[model samples]
Target: MLPADTESESYRFYKSLNEDILLKPNEFNEWDMQFENGDVVNVTGYESLQNAICIAIMTRFKELKNPLYADFGCRIHELIKANKSRMVEYKIELFITEVLTNMRRVKKINWIKVTDNPNNEFFKYLVEFSVTSIYDKIVEGEVNL
Candidate 1:
């Protein structure tokens, strides 16, 4: 097969994954991706693109369901909702730091220190910042700050 065909197949395989699994926030979301001929691959293969996007999102959700220490903080929402009483405040940053601490099995002070001056209100601001960063990073591959 031609080199282009091989590349096309590779794209198709990855693209098919999104379709079969239905991952959201699809490959069209990748700003860095470009086409020499200026034809967008993700937009062209629309149905499979949608599926691939959904699958990708579901995979991320699964990872969040049970995460490593670093990732647990990133997925605090899932954890708190799972065990509300265990999370005292249920505010976002509090939830993030708590879940991260539990996953690490570390003292709260350490996580707080890493988070920078972790007061309750300050932590709330940090939570908003982190969420915004995640969205920006995913959509544009650049965190706002």
Candidate 2:
């Protein structure tokens, strides 16, 4: 957990892992709820850093088709939806690299692997990547589309 004073200053200060409230008090509201045991939950430190990276990879960019929201998600999903050839795999890897390196907390992206899900008719992909955070912490995870 981050110190209360620096909670707002650090991008890694996410909502408590066990609580719905944001780490920063000013960002909290009545809508946020607490656990029955009164435990404050937030994804701080390495967890928050890793979650941010995962969200960026999973999200599609510029999803204009949905009328409700525009400019959301990454293009990798669109490429998969189009049923592109093997080259799409390379593109997904590049996109993940581009997105992660651009983030302030992401120091470097070690590697990215994009594999097709043969069982899925939609050409879904299984994404796995490792990144070095600014704090020198290495985080890695896989996302299945």
Candidate 3:
């Protein structure tokens, strides 16, 4: 992996795309994307698209976009939007349940540890690691997916 200060053209591009989509009014279609069209608008709430962005990043890093992961990302966004601003104590359990419920619709999730204790640091680490991988994965794609 490159150092933090290392400048990656891919990173810059993803950062720009992330900024664009996050700020776009309504859902912007990929086919209609224009880089120099407008200044970005500020975004307020976290939406399902954000989860899609994260998943896109991860799949991009893998240099391969799996249909499953794409579906997983969309599912993430749906689950997230459905459950807004719950207490911190219940957040992990709710997130796990959401993951399991959605995964059951397709395939069983390979990794799950929150059933024992939702607040476990390991579970937190797993989620964070996956999300961060998405960022790196985006860089790997070197193109918007």
Candidate 4:
């Protein structure tokens, strides 16, 4: 369970999307501040959750340079790079479940839907899922890869 302070707060601390900087709320216009500082603007609530899920799914495990960030991603990318087979889909489902559930903010993953994209020249899948946050907020999102 999330602490009462986290659950009740209107804004949550998150890293910038493009840069490794933290965003904090203040009396000054936050959006302008981000642009002025050359940091990606912050996201809130469902958008924040969706971004996190997308990042986890898209990133390959151990792809990051820092060893401490080694476990922050899923193995879905490996499956995508492998030969197309039924087993790949099954592995994707399992990987998604494991990665999403392990996230600090994700309380539970309701389901993950993987669909084949035959026409896409690069990506072979369209992955979708619904997740319930530790704060009890349910949000659904999709990612193509």
Candidate 5:
């Protein structure tokens, strides 16, 4: 082992969890990850980082079905069915920060912004943000709340 903090922060942080279980958000909803074929998908690099970001933000804190993921989720679910307002926007931003700020793949959160869409009052929140990944690559992601 290298002594005294010789490893790069990205490598050190993402040493163990550099990839996530293949769960395509676009294809599946609510963690129901499945493919047409009975084959498992394994991914790494930026794609894994992207999936991790989405999973963290979409999950309700302590709401995961898996006990191992008891602590892997965002607290924004508390705002579900909440009235749209500035305070809600702020809280959304805060919650996103709290969740993504600590991810092993995230180097730094560039910015987080919440916008309202007047079309769907019940469930229409667009949360957008940018982050520097552990590989020193800037990746942009968004989550709908």
Candidate 6:
């Protein structure tokens, strides 16, 4: 049996892609994803995508053109203006852009796809998207609203 070498090319490749701290909701948080303890778990590229999707879906951006500007929970019912689906799609693109602006891993948003869910009454829409890649690796995420 051969002992693994951390200096090996394969090991280094994996380390570069995987050696990152995973962030989580800590015991105490006020806003802006605050954590006094700075708690983190396993490192994962997919987790970043998942979190970004969640944040985008959960919040309504004050400025759709700007990043990191949002308020919790969009009033979808009342805010439905002319062209409901288009409005939702636009908002999602902006929200995803906002979240991924600071994320170093994801290069660009490939696309933001919004679809109708006829069966689900509570969530009439489903959002699907991909933020391209992190170090040549792809990650996908989704939201239902």
Taken over the whole model, the C-alpha lDDT of each candidate is: 0.30, 0.60, 0.31, 0.66, 0.73, 0.52
Over 4 Å off, model 6 = 1-43, 56-85, 118-123
Task: Give lDDT: candidate 1, residue 51.
Answer: 33
lDDT of 1 by residue, 1-145 (tens): 2123334553555332222222223333432333445443343123343232223222323364544523422433344334333233344345444443332112222222123223543322222211111112211111100
- Candidate with top TM-score is 5
- Please report the candidate that would top lDDT against the real structure: 5
Better of 2 and 5 by lDDT: 5
Candidate 5 wrong stretches, greater than 4 Å: 1-17, 26-37, 64-70, 118-122
TM-score of 3: 0.21
For candidate 5, the TM-score is 0.73
Please identify which of the two predictions, 4 or 5, would achieve the higher lDDT against the true structure. 5
Residue 95 error, candidate 1, Å = 1.2
Reference-based TM-score, model 2: 0.61
Model 5 Cα lDDT, one tens digit per residue, 44-98: 5565687788888887788877877778888888998788888998999998999
Candidate 4 per-residue lDDT, tens place, 1-145, comes to 2122244233443222122222332443131223334445555555667767777776788788887786888987776458866688788888999889778878888889987764564446767899887777787987666
All candidates: TM-score = 0.21, 0.61, 0.21, 0.68, 0.73, 0.47
Give lDDT: candidate 4, residue 17: 16
Tell me the lDDT of model 3 at 136.
31
Of 2 and 5, which scores higher on TM-score?
Answer: 5
What would the per-residue lDDT of candidate 6 be over residues 1-145, giving only the tens digit for each residue?
2223457553456443333333343333212442335443333345545665465445554536455454433433344453556666666556556665555556677767767653565335666777755665566766555
